[model samples]
Target: MRPVDFEYTSPTSIEEVVRSLADGGGEATIMGGGQSLMPVLRMRMADPDLLVDLRRVPELKQVREEGDHLVIGAMTTHHTVAHDPLVAAHAGVLGQAAASVGDPQIRYRGTIGGSLAHADPAGDIAPAVLALDGAIEISGPAGARTVPAAEFFHGPFTTALDEGEVVTAVRVPKHTGWGMHYEKFAQVAQSWCIVAVAAAVQVEDGAVARARLGMANMGQTPLRAEAAEAALRGAPLQQGALHDAAARAGEGTSPAVDAAGTAEYRRHLAGVLAGRAVTAAAGVGG
Candidate 1:
C-alpha cells in the first residue's frame, strides 16, 4: 500500500515547522523518525495533505541538564537514550525502558517525541514517562507551554497537544536516589508490550515515601496505578508491602479485551508485574 499523495517539507528550524503546521490547519503530520507514522501512512489510515519533516531541526536533538531536570530533546533517538551516560546516572528507568522499545534498527531511528506523539497505548515510553513524572514542552503559534505527563495523554493515540504545536523537549526530573524498575511482558523481543509496568519508589528510613506505578495497555492510555501507589505509601519497603500494593494494581483500569490478552488476564498480569517492578525498585527481591 502506498500513502496518499502529499506535499513534503523539511524545515530547518522549529519556528518554520510551527509555521508550516499552523498553515496546514490540522491537515499536516510531522514526521520525525516516522517509525510509527510511516506505517499509518502506508496503510492509508492517515492521509494528511502536508508532511512536515523535523529532520533538519537540529535544536530538537539535544540532551542536557537544566538545574534539577534532564532536558531531553524530543528528536533524541531511543538508542541515544539507552546509551547516554547522563540518562543512566540520573534516570536509569528511562534508559532501561528505552532499551526495550524495539530491535536495534528501530531504536536507532525512533525518536522520543515521535513515540510520545504517536500516543500508542502499548508504547514503552508512555508508561516510563508516567512513572518518571516527566513533562513535555510544546511550541506553537501562540508561543510555548508545558504539559505534565499525567495530563498529556488523553486516550489511545491521542494527546493534549494543540493542533499546531510541536513537542520540542521532554523534562525528566533527576531521580538520583530514587529506586526504579521497568518490567514488560511481550510476545517476542521486538513486539509491543502485553502488560508492562514501570515503578519508581522513594524510600526513607526503610519505609516508602513515594511510589509511582505506570501500566501499559491497561486502558485507553498508559495509566497510573493510583491505587497501587496509594497502597504503598508509608508502608515498609518489604515483600509484604509490595505484594499488597501489587494486588491493587488494576483497581481503576478498564482494559480492553484483545488478542494480546483478555482484560482479566491483563488485570492479573498487571498485579503480578507491578509487584515485580515495585519489589525491584524497593530492593526487596534484589
Candidate 2:
C-alpha cells in the first residue's frame, strides 16, 4: 500500500508552521517525529493534501524548567524525556511512563506531543500526564493557550485541539518528594496496553496523604481515577486498603471490547494493575 501523492514542507520555526497550516485551509496536518503519521500514511488511512513537518522547529525541541514546572517541547523524543534529569527530579512519574513506551527505536523517534495529539486511549504518556496533573501547551494563529491534562482528551483518538492548533509543549508542575509508579499489562513489551495504571503518592504520618491516579484503555480517553484517588486519601498504605481503593479504578470507565479482550477483562486488569502501581508508589509491598 502506498500513500496518495502529497506536498510536504518542513518548517524550522513555529510561526512558519502556523503560516503553512493556515494556508492549507483544513487540508494540511502537522507531522511531529512521524512515528504515528508514517504508519497511517502507509496504510492510506489518512490523506492530507499537505504535510507540515515540525522536526526542524528548534523551539519544539527544548526541555527546560519554567517557574515551578517542567516544559518539554512538543518535538522532544521519548528517549530524551525518559532520561532528562529535570523530569526525574520533578515529575518522575511522567518519566517512568515515557520510558515504558514501545521499544528502543520507537522511543527514539516518538514524541510526547505527537502521542498526546494522537489521543490514543492506550497511549502511555497521556495517562501519566493526567496522573501528574500536567497541562498541554498549544499554539495557533490566535497565539497560545494552555489546556489542563484533565481537559485535553475528549474521546478515543480525539483531543481538544482546535483546527489549526498545534501542541507546542507539555507542562508538568513539580511534585518533588512524591513517590511515583507506572504499571501496564500488554501481550508483549512492544504491544499496546490492555490496561495501564499510573500513580503518584505522597505519604505523611505513615499514611497516604495524597494520591493521583490515571488509567488507560479503561475508557474513551485517558482518565483520572477520581474515585480511587479519593479512596486513597488518609488510607493506610496496606494491601487491603490499597486493593479496595484500586477496585474502584474502573468505576466510571467505558472500555471497548475488541480482539485484545472483553471490556470486563480490561476493567479487572485496571484494578489489579492500579493496586500494584499505587502500592508501589506508596512504598508498601515490594
Please tell me which predicted candidate would have the highest TM-score against the true structure. 2
Model 1 segments more than 4 A misplaced:
none
Error of 2 at 189 (Å): 1.8
Every candidate's lDDT: 0.90, 0.92
- Going through the candidates in the order shown, the clash numbers are 0, 0
Model 1, 94-212: lDDT tens digits are 88899999899999999999999889899898788888899999999899899998899998888998889989998999988889999999988899999899998899999999999
* Weakest 10 consecutive residues of candidate 1 by summed lDDT: 238-247
lDDT of 2: 0.92
**Clashing residue pairs, candidate 1?**
none
What's each prediction's TM-score? 0.96, 0.97
Please name the candidate that would achieve the greatest lDDT relative to the true structure: 2
CA RMSD, predictions in order:
1.3, 1.0
Residue 61 error for model 2, in Å?
A: 1.0
For model 2, give the 10-residue run with minimal summed lDDT.
245-254
